[model samples]
Target: MSFATPPGWYPDAGAPGTERWWDGTAWTAHTRPPAVVQHEPVRQPYAPQSFGPPVPLPPARGGGRTRVLAITLSGLLVLGAATTAFLLLGPDDSGTRTAPAPTTSDPAPTAPATASASATPSGEGGPDGDPAVLVDQLNGITLAVPDGWEKAKNTPDDAPTIRTAVSYDCPGTAASFCYRGTVSTRTARAGRTDPKAVAEADITAAADRAYEEDILGQRTHGGITSHKVLKAEPVAVAGRTGYLVRWQVVTAKGPGGVVQSVAFPSEAGIGTPVIVRLAFDADRPELPVSLMDTITRSIRPIGDSATSGGVGASIGP
Candidate 1:
């Protein structure tokens, strides 16, 4: 039958006992038995049918259930993808996302080490605390305190001096105590710059002060009637070339005494000249002449490692 005929089940002329299903344009293989009619029905006109190969059918329409199932599957796939992403890239327990760790090519920063109080540099105030050492900060030098000697307690702070621990009444005047040995240091006054000249010029005054008279015009060491030069020569002190002059003075009322003046360039300030004066009783067995050499050899720059005075330098005869 042609498409003008509506789609329905009709009697199959080719197979009389059964009815076949006809779509709008063509017949399908579906079939069922003919129903019984209670009375004679009107007959409709039919065109002659030819038997040919069956034609392919188009897709079915109005498939609401199939469309709904397809949509549900797509939604599940999308939800599963979102859940996977969140689990792999979520925040930590702290509620803050941590950055990726640095690779070998990118190094991490490190904090610097802290310094301790004990790490202070050497020689600043190291020797000042030693009882056997005398630190002269103004001249930037240190002297070894010899045996039986101590720092001069009565000396002014501006003046660095040391003396023998023992003292005796002055022979010429009983008003004051006389030390058997004394050593004092000071920056050179505005006079001679040459170390040798300074030493030579200071020796006479040193002798007079030690034995001749005191500042009050009293004979502290009896009376200095004569003086003799014991030694005068160039010496090295605290790594600098210097000079020293030693003199023997004869006193009137007691055994004579020896005096010495040493001058050198100071290593602390602007290379100024420094003078060290020494006085010792000649007759005292403990205050030998060689003690002067020992004390001079023990001088050193404030920060130097050498405690035996200058660089292999000697003073006095």
Candidate 2:
């Protein structure tokens, strides 16, 4: 290595560990070998040096996604707690309420006004006594039972029934043999507005379809059809409403041999009339039509109108 000193090169004191390279513009003694500071090429900031536009910032108040999720869960928990409290305090009303117990001091229900008034006992009617008179009083009205009739008690525990069966064998053609009585007061479902109308309807029914269509089929209608109205009166008895219909029923049993039908009285309740029903085969023309007439025509409202509102056996052919 021959030493050749250029004009601009000299021994370096400041750059002790470096070499000098000069292209002679001025005296160059020391030079830092182009300080190859080989730092990993300093990377520029990852942002555009000149931002073209500003970035929009996210909302800062409500919360981030995770905070929102936490809040929603908390709300649901509160709702569940409220629902549990309501269920704990709510009343159950799915069952029927029990009836209140009756107090011991409650007054006992008494018989109806008509019933109490019409509670007549059985007795004997005279030879001309129309047995159905008491039945009339029991039905819906009070009436005279032809001077000698008496009323008998009945069996059914509810309705008012009085049998006016004759104690003595009545003349087969007697008019007032029996006073079958029937009555119904205000119940869960029955009523009579114009008691007279109810009475008329009942009589028509008995003398017409109820008796004729049901048992007579074509039996001779004797009681009402044959009789002309003699008198009618309003009456009340035994807490019931009723009337008394009096008339003479003409019955013709044989040709030119008509027997004068006796006048008997019948009584029934307005709501339920004493209907006398009789049945006989078409061939049995000799049925006790008189008895039937007596039973039906005799029906009258027995005792009362202030408040409100029979049976048989087989005749061996």
TM-score for candidate 1, please give it: 0.57
Model 1: residues >4 Å from true position, as ranges?
1-125, 156-158, 308-317
Residue 95 of model 2 has an lDDT of 48
Q: What is the per-residue lDDT of model 1 for residues 1-317, given as tens digits with 9 covering 90 to 100?
A: 11134444445565666544454456655444543231333121132253342332231333465467558767876786666666666777998765544323224323221111111115344555566776665455777787668887566334678888888999888897788898888777654579998899888878877788876688887888988989999998877899999999899978889999999987654245888889999878777888887888678876575443222332222
Tens-digit lDDT string for candidate 2 (228-291): 4443455442323445343333333312111111111223211333322222211223433343
Quantify all predictions' global Cα lDDT against the true fold: 0.66, 0.30
Alpha-carbon deviation at 7 in model 2, angstroms? 99
Can you give the TM-score per candidate against the true fold? 0.57, 0.25
Worst 10 residues of 2 by lDDT: 254-263
The global Cα lDDT (0 to 1) of model 1 is 0.66
